[model samples]
Target: ADLQEATVLTATAEFLDDHTVRVSDNSGQETLIADRIFINTGATPIWPNIDGLLASKHVYSSTDLLVKDKQLKELVILGSGPIGLEFASMYAQFGSHVTIIDKSSKILGHSEPEIAEQAKNDLEEDGVSFLLESNLTGVNDTLNGVTLTI
Candidate 1:
């Protein structure tokens, strides 16, 4: 395998110049000068500026939901995009009561209207609900779960 000969280091790299980088890890730091350099910047969740959202312990991002071990009996997802629909479908099939709220009038705005309608129908058959043309005004974290003011 070609990857066997390549050096692999897991560290934060700071680009110093066009060809030099300062890499740091828990052990120490090292300066590397290479003809070619690659950087893999992973994804980070973008939270809305809605009130009580950031402070709520019940709120979970897609990444956070991945590591969460708790079983969610009810779920309210914000958005009807590809990722949002994916979560809604998966969770609904998993026996969770999933509801998707979006500002748009329809789901899968980028797709054909007929296709989108079919997808919505399929999701509905799976026990998923949709709140279209709705806006999330605020959030409230109760003893049971987080509540959304739409």
Candidate 2:
């Protein structure tokens, strides 16, 4: 494949000058000079500031949930965006009790109302719960599970 023949360097890239870039990895460092350079930095999940949430060991970002192989019985998602709803749907299909809380009036606030309602209905049929106009006030990690106060 073309990818197999490509030279891929996994490292932190920094623009040294207009035509130079510095890449550093665990192996060593390298300076690459080119007329044009492209950067493809990925996005990271942003965690909200809720009381006791930062201190809780059970708190996980969306990315963390993707990489982890834990079997969850109950999941409390803090947002109702596309990513959050997707996770809710997946977990609900996996037989987890999924609850999604959002500060808006409905899920997928940026999408068309009818489409969003249809998606919400489908998720609800799958046993997903939604708490609209709700804000997470605190979090408590119990011995058996984590409790979220919304």
Candidate 3:
């Protein structure tokens, strides 16, 4: 609520010194300098370097999936991390055929082994398919759906 009432400045910030920084917008406005500043940058999805992946119209990031309100029939997720697993579970519950592919042998490679295994089992029981120890080599956009090469 407090943030909504505050005046927001959309600008690029550049550090002038150790304690000062300059903020300027695209419009030829005068740059404002602040003695103290806090940086709050958000995160973006890092796509892998794969042949014809970026050019495909069917490809979507985790962020993209979140904001999309349309229902999907088939979804082929390329990663088995938290984002991929969560989306798989959500989409499966919504009646979408979800397929998750990962290069690692196990799902949730960064989490505890037992926990990851349990989660993977739960997702599988919910009708989400897992393709482990596989790498996505290519992606092709089809008229009906996107085809992924694993």
Show the colliding residue pairs in model 3: none
TM-score for each predicted model, relative to the true structure:
0.68, 0.69, 0.69
- Relative to the unseen true structure, what is the C-alpha lDDT of residue 90 in candidate 2, on a scale of 0 to 100? 71
Q: How far out, in Å, is residue 45 in model 2? A: 1.2
* Candidate 1: residue 52 lDDT (0-100): 89
Query: Which ranking of candidates, highest lDDT first?
Result: 2, 1, 3
Instruction: Supply the global lDDT for candidate 2.
Output: 0.83
Task: Kindly provide the TM-score of model 3 when superposed on the true structure, using C-alpha atoms.
Answer: 0.69
Off by over 4 Å in 3: 1-43
**Ten residues in a row with the worst lDDT in model 3?**
1-10
Off by over 4 Å in 1: 1-44
CA displacement after TM-score superposition, residue 125 of candidate 1 (Å) = 0.4
Clashes of each: 0, 0, 0
TM-score of 1: 0.68
